[model samples]
Target: MILHLVSSPPQINLDLTDCVSNSESDATLQHNCLHVTGSIDKETDSRQFISYCMNEYSPKWNIQSNSRERKFTFVELYKHNITSRHLYLWSAPMDVAERYQFYLDQLSISNEASMATQLFYNCTPPRFGPICQYAFDDYRPDHLSLNEIIHDFYLHGYEPTTLTCYVHLQCDRGPAPACLDWSEICDGKVDCLDGGRDEEHCWQLEANECADDQYRCVNGQCIPYTFFRDNTAIPDCLDGSDEYFESKDKRANCKIAESVFECEDLTCTIGHRSWASPLTSSCAQSRSDLLIKAMFLHKPNSVLDECWSAFLCIIHGSNPSDTICGDFCVGQTFNHERKTVRSSYGIKIEF
Candidate 1:
C-alpha cells in the first residue's frame, strides 16, 4: 500500500518508496534513512491541503462535501450568527497564516485566542462569489522561485486588488463612484441616475424579421406593422421610428401615442394640446427643451386651445414671459399636433 506521510510544515513534500526486508542468521540488516523528494503540483497540493484540514481540523471544519468535491468553505469567522461571505486570494501557507493574523488583528479574536480556526474558503455561492483563483501548475519552493510562482498565479487569475461591481461587469460606468450591483443593471431603472448610463449598451439589435401581420419594433419586439398595405397609416412603434414621411410632406397616416397638436416647429415631434404642456419630458424623453422655454402667447378663450403662439422673441437673453415677448409674436402660429387614438395590441404570437 502507498502511504503518503504528510510533513508537519506543508511547504515540504516527501514520497517514501520502500521494500520489505529482514535480517538472516549472523547477518545484521543496516538501513539508512531514505530521502524522497516531491514537487508541489497545484492539483495535488489542493488534495493535500484538503487532507490536512480534514485530518487536523476535523469537527471544526464541518465539511459536507465528498472526496470528489475538493472544495469546502468555513463560515462564522467574525460575527456571531450574522450572515456574511468572503472571497480571498492567497499564494502560500504563509499567506494563509497572514490571513489568520488579520482575523486576530481585526479583533475577530483576541491575542489570547485559541489556536482554532473558525472559517475558510469552500464550495458555496454556486460559483465563486468574489474570488482569486490561481491555475498555476506547481508552486514548489525547491523547483520554482516565489516571483515565478506569483507570476503564474497572476497569469492564471489573480487581481491586484478588489474589483468593483461595474468593473466586474465591465460596464462603462457605475451608478456611483465605486458601487456596482449586477441586479441593478439593465432592469429598466436608472440606478446610476446619470441619464440611464448604467442601462446603456445592455442590449442590442440581433436580428429583424417578422411573420405576416407582425410589425417588428426597433427594440426587436415583433408586433403588427401594418394592417393594410398602401393605406395612410402611422406606425405603432413606440419611438415612432417606423413611421416615414412619403413625398417630403412630412405627413403620414400614423398611430400616435396620443391625440395631440403638432408644434409650429416642424422639426419638433412633441405635440401638446396640454397633457404635456406642463411637463417637459415624457416616457420616451422626446420633449424639446427649447420649445418648453419658447415664447408662448396664450390664445385665451380659444376653441380647444386651438393654437399657442411660440413667437420668436427679439429681446436678447429674455424669456417668453418677458413683458416685450408678445411684441414679436404678432403673426406666429403654432399648429395643434394631430394624431389618431392609440391602437390596442393588434397582433398575437403563434406560440
Candidate 2:
C-alpha cells in the first residue's frame, strides 16, 4: 500500500493504526480505510482519482482548511451509487515520496519519449500497453516499494525483454528473425528460411542415440516419441521410416507404435518382410484372409494407410478412417516452423 504520488503535492502523513476508532463497531471499517490513498496512486489514469474514491468510498467525509479554521464536512460523493461502501486512504513515507518526485521530474525531461512514457502516460512499472491501460492482476503487489520498482526499470528497461529462440535452436540468420523449437531442430526437417540452420548439424543426430522422449528415424532423425506410428500418411522421419508399415527396415530396428498389435504366431505369417505382418487366425479369429489381402494385395503408395485401416479392422472390427486414423493422407511434408506439435494428439506413448 506504499504510494508514490507522481505529482508534487504536500500530503499529510498519518499512520493507519492511529486512525482506528475506540468503538468496536467502527474499528474494522476505519482500519480498512488505512490503505486506499495508495490505491488511487497505483492506477495509471489520474482522472480516476475522484471517480474511484466516490465509487469506492461512497459515505465520505471532507476535511478542509478555511483561513485558519479546521472544518469537517460530510458529503454524498456518489449520489446514484450508495451500495459501494469500501474506501481507504494511506500515506507514503517522506523518503519514498521525495524519491518519486525526483525521478518523475528527471524522466519528464529525457530525450527519448519511451524513457518517460511510464511517468508521462501515468502507468506504473510492469504495467504496459497503450496509455499504460493493461496490466496483469499480480503485476502490482501491496508490499512492493517505489524504489525497488525504479531499480527494476534501470536494470531491465520498463518493458520485459523478449528472448529470441533462434540462437538456442541454432537457426540460420535471415532478413526476418526466425525462431525454432527444440523439437524442430534436427528432426529431419528444414525450418529456417535462410539456409536451413535447423538441419545443419543433423549429422550429430544420426550419430547419437535419441532421448527417452524422442524416436530415432532410420536416417537417425530424432522426432518426438509420439511421432512414431502416428497413423499419418505423411512420414515423420526424413526416410519415411515412421510410416513405413511392414517395411523390413522398420521392424529390423524394432521401432513400432504401442497401438500396433504384432502377431506372435509364425503359423499365420504370409510375408517375410519385417514390417509386413497381417493378423492371422492364430492371433485372432475374424477377417484373417481379408487382413492378409489388404496388407499384401495392393502396393499402396503410403504404407501408413493400408496397415492402419487393416489393423484397426482386425483389432476392433472398425475402419480406422471412421475412428482413429488422422485426416492427412496427402503425402505432404509439414512446415515445422509454423506448427509446433505436428501430431494431432501430442502425447508421449511410453512402451
lDDT of 2 by residue, 1-351 (tens): 222334222122212322335454452233221112212222322211111101123134343322321211111211222111111111332222333344445545763333222211222444322122233333335325433332233334222122223345545422222234343455444556557776786787568798999988775668898868874433556445676443334332222111012212111223334333332212222223333333333333433554434333434435445533333222332212221111111111111
| Prediction-by-prediction clash tally | 14, 5
Off by over 4 Å in 2: 1-119, 124-130, 143-179, 182-197, 201-351
Per-residue alpha-carbon lDDT of candidate 1 for residues 152-233, written as tens digits (9 for 90 to 100): 4434432222222433444432212223344345444444433556567756533566787787655455656553232222
TM-score for each predicted model, relative to the true structure: 0.19, 0.19
Candidate topping lDDT? 2
Whole-structure CA lDDT of model 1: 0.30
Find the 10 residues in a row with the least total lDDT in model 1.
342-351
113 Cα displacement, candidate 2 (Å): 16
lDDT of each: 0.30, 0.34
